[model samples]
Target: MELTTLWFLIVGVMLIGYFVLDGFDFGVGMALPFLGKDNTDRRLIINTIGPVWDLNETWLIVAGASLFAAFPEWYATMFSGFYLALLLILVALILRGVSFEYRHQGKGEQWTRWFDQFIVWGSVVPPLLWGVAFANLVQGLPIGLLPNGGWIYEGTLLTLLNPYGLLGGVVMVLVTFTHGLVFISLKTTGDMRERARALATKVGIGAILAGAVFLVWTIVMHLDHELLWLIVTCAAIAALALIGGFVANLAGREGWAFTGNAVGIAFALLTIFSALYPYLMYSTIDPAFSMSIEGAASSQKTLELMTWVAVFTLPLVLAYQAWTYWVFRKRLTRETITAGAH
Candidate 1:
């Protein structure tokens, strides 16, 4: 209800949008070798996402910008502390974007092959690192206060490579990979659809397993949290949605499968955000050093101004993006790809 809380929720919404949308984009990129049997097949796979991948990515940009504007301290601490990891994510994204554009323009199969590899790796590194980063946030970071009233992150990159963080990364990779496969099932036809659905059913099991572990760990960590009920509820929904997705995929119901995965991913993130509600970043060193939402928020005037701007702009952006997806709603087929229809 307050401006600070409203902005926090807005930022969360933007991030959830990114992960749900671009999450599948990453999965599709990673599924390249498995689903793409030939150049044409690969093209079909790529074309399935080509129209909207860039658009999906804009959600991340909006999320980042909102963080910087609405909660500068949180953004500053996170960006500075996670500099190396964020840099890697940035490079990977750039490489993936470049590969999407240049893969077709290259002179030979070798050139395109290299870019294909880029696409796969590009899709992988960001989500893995993001999962690690968020896990560290939930697990708490070694942060201390400066004499000048600023915050300092005492831990190095290696600190983020701990068991919990690594498991988080793996879970993200598995879930997103499953999400993408389901999208492929939803967006393709004939043999491609069958193969994708079969693969999704298989991968969805791993997603369910890993996601359950991660969610249980998170819930255990937050047993004493004020929002523990919300966390538990969201986690339960996420787990069920994942299982439901697997069953839907097995039953050859692509739309429901995709929707199930999407809901699972969204609620899983909601679980995390709920757990992190009061604090922007928790301090392992001392609770006194932790950054609370109120501590991290921008001035009240700034938040109010931003709220007005969002009220005007957010719906238009949503409408345009929804229209784009609707326009590209038709399934892609081998014939469509061979006939050069994207």
Candidate 2:
């Protein structure tokens, strides 16, 4: 494969990793206001994700760094075009992470409650905005070529708030919320698990409707007829997986339910990245201004060197993270959470 194509897949893999890990984290955060009826309940909810939320987030950093190094032009144009939106996502991430750490530093209940609010909003905004951001990026941006061999983004924040962008935001937020509910059902036991399962059933239905709309819209707009069947196949699997997840939750098969939900989430992301193949960013203003893998890539030497570095280090990183999850694999209980709370 060409180095440019290789880096595109690598970057795509990293992004998928981020979504799989942080996707559940976002779900858990969005659930706080719903499942956490009391302080102990909230504590239980938080504890489910508390051990590894930060670690899950590192995938996003890795993905961003990879994008910056391998495809600077794509990064440059995307970041500049989505400046305000990206800033908001950054702020939300900080608040969400901080809430996990500082909400228990001998602070009062009120302080914790306030921080919980922050956590919820923090979780809420990013998925929504990310949906919007990615939608706008894929729907195409007002990017243009300069006189010199450079690119410039000529759109404002308002440009990204178009209907399709906003719909993308809503779809992601709902999807993550349901994904978290499934996770909660799996990792928690007793009343909290039951509540999570119940809520997930309801949320799952809405998620299916919203997700179906977005999935169909994506296929209709971006995919070519030759490859249409392939994307449609992925979308079908996603729909089935989501339905299975909700059904499994209702049947008290929590692990199976979580797996189904996770599979759906993965396929959903795959559909998007696959639709974006060849082109990193398509310029709405002019197709000639579109950025593709070959156009945006760094020097061949840079890619070759990075490939060697990745060959040595990436496996170790994945192994260590997998080990971390294995160590923390046991389910959380209301008793455990209450004990920690006291």
Candidate 3:
């Protein structure tokens, strides 16, 4: 494949990584109020993700940085078009990071509660906006080319609140919630695990249903593309994976259940990227105005250099992350959380 095509696939892979890894971070945070009924339960939830949440977030940094470097047009158009929404996500993320450290600083209930709200705000907003953003990317935007041979987005935030975009946000929120419940089950023991497993089973059903609607809608809307068969296959597999995840969770097989949820998310992303292949962002106004992968990508020489850098750095990053997970790999318990709390 050409360097441009290779970079496109690589970018997609990095985004999928971000969704799967940081996805649960958001999920766990969303689950906090519900699963964590009291202080101990809350502490348990926080500790479960504390060690690796920041590490998981690196996937997003990598994905965003890669996009900015590899496809400046796509980056510029999107960042500018979704400026307000992205700002909200950025603010929420910063607040969420601060909340984590601040939660420990104050020993009082009101103080901890304030920080907890920040975590929820930070976690819930981004996934919702990300879904809306990616969904809009697929559905097309009112973008036009300028006299300077650059692209400009012609719509406001209201332009992105359309039904399709809203549904995309719902799916993202639901999937992340279910994903977090599964992670909670995997990382916790005792009654906490039971609560997480049960919640995951229930929430996963809704997530799968929403995801199915989004996938099918995406397929129907883009059926004229050359990769229809691939899209259909991936969507089908994604549905099955989602169902399998629910079943595995119901059966108390947290490991398999987590794998199934992660795989389901991966396949769902595959469905989106497959339909959106070749075109980085579709044009709602005119076919000629669309931003294609080739049109959006940097030069071949830049892509080649980036590819070599990625080859050398990516493996080490993955290895270090893997080692981190291995080192922290053990089920946390309510007793452990309680012991650490005091």
Candidate 4:
């Protein structure tokens, strides 16, 4: 494959990784109130993800860096156009991270309780807004490319709040919530496990319905035919996976349930990528000024060098992640949390 194509593949993989890993993190955060009815329940839910929450976020860093290196023009345009939304996401993430650590530092329930709310809000907003941002990115925005090649956003924040964007946000929220419930089922036992399984089953069904609606609306907007087919296929697969996971969870097959949720997210992300195939950014006002993979890529030599660098470094990152998971593979329990190891 050509260097540009190779870079696209790498970036695509990175995004898939982000969706799979962080999808569950966001899911768990959303599930906190539902799965954790009391302090003990909350501790158990939190403990299930404590060891790996930070690690799961590394995929985002990799995705961002890859975009900057391989598609600098796209990055520049998107960063500038979606500056406020990105800023809000960054603040939410920071709040989530800080809350995770400091929430447990105090003995008072009020102190930790307030921070727990922050964590939930932090987790919820990012994915929802990100979906909206990506939906707008794919749907097209009012932007223009200058003679010197820099891009300008002619629309305001309200422009990103269209029906399609709202649909994307809701889909993402439901998808991530289901993803976390599956993980919680797999990583905990006893009451917490049962609660998580039941919740996962419920959220899985909701996600399937929401996803279907989003797919129909997306097609109704008259996207490219090939892209529409690809997205429809992916959406169908995701819906099927969600139903399969719900059935498996009902049957007490935790592993199968988790696998189904993972597949669901994989297909959902594929649907997003399919819809955004050639264009990184579309223009609502002028189709001629839209940015495509070819127009956004860096120089041939730069891409070639990055490909070589990715070859050596990507495996090391994967290995480290594997090691971390292996080291902390034990199921989380109330006893473990009460012992203060969390």
Best by lDDT: 1
- What candidate 3 gets wrong by more than 4 Å, as runs, is 338-342
Tens digits of per-residue lDDT, candidate 3, 1-342, equal 998889899999999999999999999999989998888888899888899998998898898899999999999999999999999999999999899877867868899899999999899999999999988988999989999988999999999999999999999999989999999999998899999999888898899889999999999998798999999999999889989989999899989988888998899888889988889888889989999999999998899999999999999999999999999999998778654452
User: TM-score of the candidate numbered 1?
Assistant: 0.98
Return the lDDT, model 4, position 22. Answer: 86
Ranking by TM-score: 1, 3, 2, 4
In the range 216-307, model 1's lDDT, one tens digit per residue, is 99999999999999999999999999999889888898899899999999999899899999998999999999999999899999999999
Give per-residue lDDT, candidate 3, residue 48.
Answer: 84
Model 1's alpha-carbon lDDT is 0.93
Each model's number of backbone clashes? 0, 0, 0, 0
lDDT of 1 at 188: 93
- Ten-residue region with minimum lDDT total, candidate 1: 333-342
**Could you give candidate 4's per-residue lDDT for residues 160-265 as a string of tens digits?**
9998898889889998888888889889888888888888777777888988887677666646556677778887898788788878889989889878878887
Residue-level lDDT of model 2, residues 21-117, one tens digit each, is: 8988999999999998888888888888887898889989988998999999889888887889999999999999888887876558899888899
- Against the unseen true structure, what C-alpha lDDT does each candidate score? 0.93, 0.85, 0.91, 0.83
lDDT of 4 at 73: 88
Candidate closer to the true structure by TM-score (higher is better), 2 or 3:
3
